[model samples]
Structures are given as structure tokens and as C-alpha cells.
Target: MLRIDGKKVYLVPFEEKHLVDPAYYAWLTDFEVVRYIGRDEYLKPIQFEKVREYVEELWRNRYCSFFAMHHSGDDAFIGTAKINYLNEAGFSTRTADIGIMIGDRGYWGKGMATDALFAICNYAFNDLSARKLTAGAVSANKAVIRAFQKIGFLEEGRLRKKLLISGEYMDHVLLGCFREELHPVI
Candidate 1:
């Protein structure tokens, strides 16, 4: 897909050039940004090289399709969303996991995430022919969970204490949305 344009944000194919901005590297170590997503310990010094290597892998990996989320009006890079572990075309390859991160602090709690999630999910089910999409969020991350639900993902199960945050064990909510569950987005 060239791009998935949402009401407020546009999801473009992730490219190496997207990393040129200093904010992209800085968000990797921001405590508040990575908190419930795990990696809170990234409090250590930020290394641009290591971050580049990670994004490079995503760029080259066939099983992953990552997108740089940009605000529609100004085209400002806001964050990223991804579909990982995409199985090759076949009757059996009908499910994938979705992940997202709105690294821009200024955009937090502004519904941009919800918009991006819906756009990617549309691409997954409509374009990719994915039968089901799954996502996991720490139960403490209510915002992520709510976004998933807003996009039609239903709570399927829970992984108890699957995540350790702030020295406390937290449950992980498992969510899944099937093709039939999604409203056709034209």
C-alpha cells in the first residue's frame, strides 16, 4: 500500500530517511513514552546507531510492514505503526499482530492513535486479506486497550503478570479482531 490516509494522520511506508530526525531517536529513551510499552530501563544514554540498526531490520524484513505516522495537515512525523509476523500468502496465512507507538508527546491523548489504528487495521483486513488481527497491551495501559476496542478488537484473554512495570507485575490484555468483526471502511 502506498499510504493509508486517515482523518488526522497519514500512515506512510517506513523508510530509513524517517530516522533522520533527532526526535525519533530521543523517543526511544523517553521514560514516559516507553513506560507501559516496556523498555522503561532505556533510561540509559541513547545510541543512534543501535536505533538505526533496529529500524533497518524492520525495513528489510519481509514479515513486517512498518509505517511512519504523519499528521495530515502539516505532514509532521508523529509516530509509527506496524504489522509484524506477516505470513506468506496462503489459506493458512490469515492472521497478524499489530503494534503502534505515538512517540510525539504533543499528540498524546488526542485521538490520533485511534485514527492511525483504524487506518492500519483497514489495510490489514481489506488489502492484506488478513482474517484476524491481534494485539497485546499491558492492562495498565488503558489508552492502548481502549484504542484497540475502538477499532473493533475484542478482549480475547489475558496474560497474568506478563509485564513488569515500575517494579510491579501487570496483566497483559490479549485482543483480536476478525475480518467479519470489522466494518468495511471504504
Candidate 2:
């Protein structure tokens, strides 16, 4: 179990307790935030149930990990971050991908994402032997791109028409960072 903490934020292992909250459903239903992450519709209880089922499967893996982000003020849960694709084959053994979301729109532009990324990556590299990380952003989202860049991820390339969001195809911006070259801004 990986635990990273700060004055206002902390990251903990994703658990069944985290999903028991009703706010998660509200966050998953928020169109502005879910526009880039979820399918066209809002995620219902059954949907999150499925997510829980899938996550439990992930927890049984050798390297698979995910965290539930929480705040210190209200102790309110904000979002989640996941490090999947934990295979031992090839160079993957040294690398782990990252994905995050701040479910509370009220916390937007407050550097919570930045804080969470820094804490998560620090734990990943030093604690989990993670050497590299990557994240993707759909064209409809500029905040995700900016957040990734703030963490020192450079624009590797764009995957054309990779997502169908808001009823049309959208492009994907691939961003990455490595242990040898972690971006300071991150």
C-alpha cells in the first residue's frame, strides 16, 4: 500500500470504502469533468459497481496500482489516479502509466492535480521502481494537456481521431516523462 501525504492533499490505495461514497457518483456524472474520461453517458451505481469489480481484479496483479485522492480540509474525496499496464515483459517492467481526475469542479485550477501528480510520481519512481510514465489527452481538453505539461511532460505527438467525444471524433495528445528526465514543473 502506497500512502503519500501533504498539508491539503493525500493519496491512498483505492479501496471498496472509497467507492461507497455518493459523491463519486456525482463526480462521474459531471459532464464537464467526465467529458474526457467516461463514455457518452453518466456512470450509474451499476457502472461504478463494474468499476469496483474491475479494480478488484487489478489489485491482484503484481504491479497494478491505483489511488483515491483526498483533501485535508473537509477530508473530502476529490478524485482518483491509476497506474496500470504493469506487465513484466519488455521495458514495461521499468515503466508505469498514469491517469488522474479531480472529481470536484470546485477544486479546479487550484494546483491539486499538480500536487497529486508530484506525490504520485515520487512514490512511483522511488517506491515502486517506476522509471517512466505516460498520459493521454483528448483534443476537447486543454486542462489535461496543461496539467501534464506542468508536470514536465513534453508533447510527444498527437494520435489523430482516437476518441469519440461529444458526438464526434477527437485527437489524442500523448505526453510522457521518465526517471532520467522528470519535468521540474510537474
Candidate 3:
């Protein structure tokens, strides 16, 4: 459970203990927080224990590397980020899918997501030997799309009406970044 230190937030390996705070479930149940998240079940309120068990299970999963995003200054829990290895049978495969969520409403629009994304990109490309990474955002999730772009992910394509949010279909913006495409931040 090593920590990846970044400018605004640092990523720590996900632990079951992280869910001790009821706020984690609170954020998951928040409409605005889960609005852009792809899961349809997340749209409805979820019980705290259910979400906790899900997170705990994630920690035990080998294909996914999850981290708790914490604000640097105050050590506040802001959200979580993860990179899922796409081809489990092929250990040599270097492709993965990246995802992030700034569940804390107060951190939205504060550039924290960009920082977290950068940290994960570095961890994936540099540490984990990932050759390429991919991610998708609901087209309406402008902030997340911008964060991915800001961190050097290029627009790969779009999936039309890929996600159903609030009974309406929204296009999913596909993005990707290669190890060679990453530009070192000054």
C-alpha cells in the first residue's frame, strides 16, 4: 500500500478501513456526485453497508488497483481512483482502464481531479509498466472530460448514447493516453 504523492492530493492504496467514515456512503448516495458515474444502480440511493462491502471486495480483487484520494494539506478523504487491468489472462498486456471520482462536493472544480489523474497516470505508465491507458466519461460530464484531457489523454472516439443518466441517454467520450504521449509537468 504505497502512497503516490501529488501536488493537491496523494493516492494511498485502498483499504477496507477507509470506509469507517459514513461520509463515503453519503457521497455515493448523493445525486450530484453519482450523476456522471456509469452505474445505473448508483442513481438510486444505496445502503451504507452495501457500498462498504463493494469497496472491501474491490480491495481483494487482483485485476483492479484502487486508491483512496486524500487532500494533501488536511489529509481529508476526497475520493477514490482506480486502474483496472483489461486482460487478466495476458499478464504481459499493458492496457488498462482508468477511472476517478471526486466524491467530495467541495473538491469539485478545484483541479483536484486533474492532480489525481496525473498521479494515477504516472503510477500506471511509470510504475506498473502500462503502455496504454483508456477511460471514458459521459459527454455531459464536462469536468471529468477536461481533467482527462488536461492530464494528456487524447480523444480516441465516442460511443453514442452509451450511458443512461436520469432516464436520458448520453454519449460517452472515449479517451486514451500512451506512455510516450505523457508530457512531464513542470
Using lDDT as the yardstick, the better of models 2 and 3 is 3
Writing each residue's lDDT as its tens digit, candidate 1 over 1-186 gives 598988999999987678888878878878888887655546567678877877888888887889999999899898999987655652366778999999999999998888899989989888877788999899988999988888788999999998888888999899999877765234
Q: What tens-digit string does per-residue lDDT give for candidate 3 at 47-92?
A: 7777877777777777788888999999999899998884574236
**Could you tell me which residue pairs clash in candidate 3?**
none
TM-score of 1: 0.91
lDDT string, candidate 2, 69-113, tens digits = 998678789998877655765235576778899999888898888
Candidate numbers, best TM-score first, in rank order:
3, 1, 2
lDDT, model 2: 0.77
Q: Which consecutive 10 residues in model 3 have the weakest lDDT in total?
A: 85-94
Select the stronger candidate by TM-score from 1 and 2. 1
Screening candidate 1 with a backbone cut-off below 3 angstroms (N, C-alpha, C), the clashing residue pairs are none
Which residue segments of model 3 deviate by more than 4 Å?
89-91, 184-186
Model 3 Cα displacement at 146 (Å)? 0.5
Per-model CA lDDT versus the true structure: 0.84, 0.77, 0.85
Question: Best by TM-score, which number?
Answer: 3
Best by lDDT: 3
* TM value for model 2: 0.86
Q: Could you tell me the lDDT of residue 45 within candidate 2? A: 31
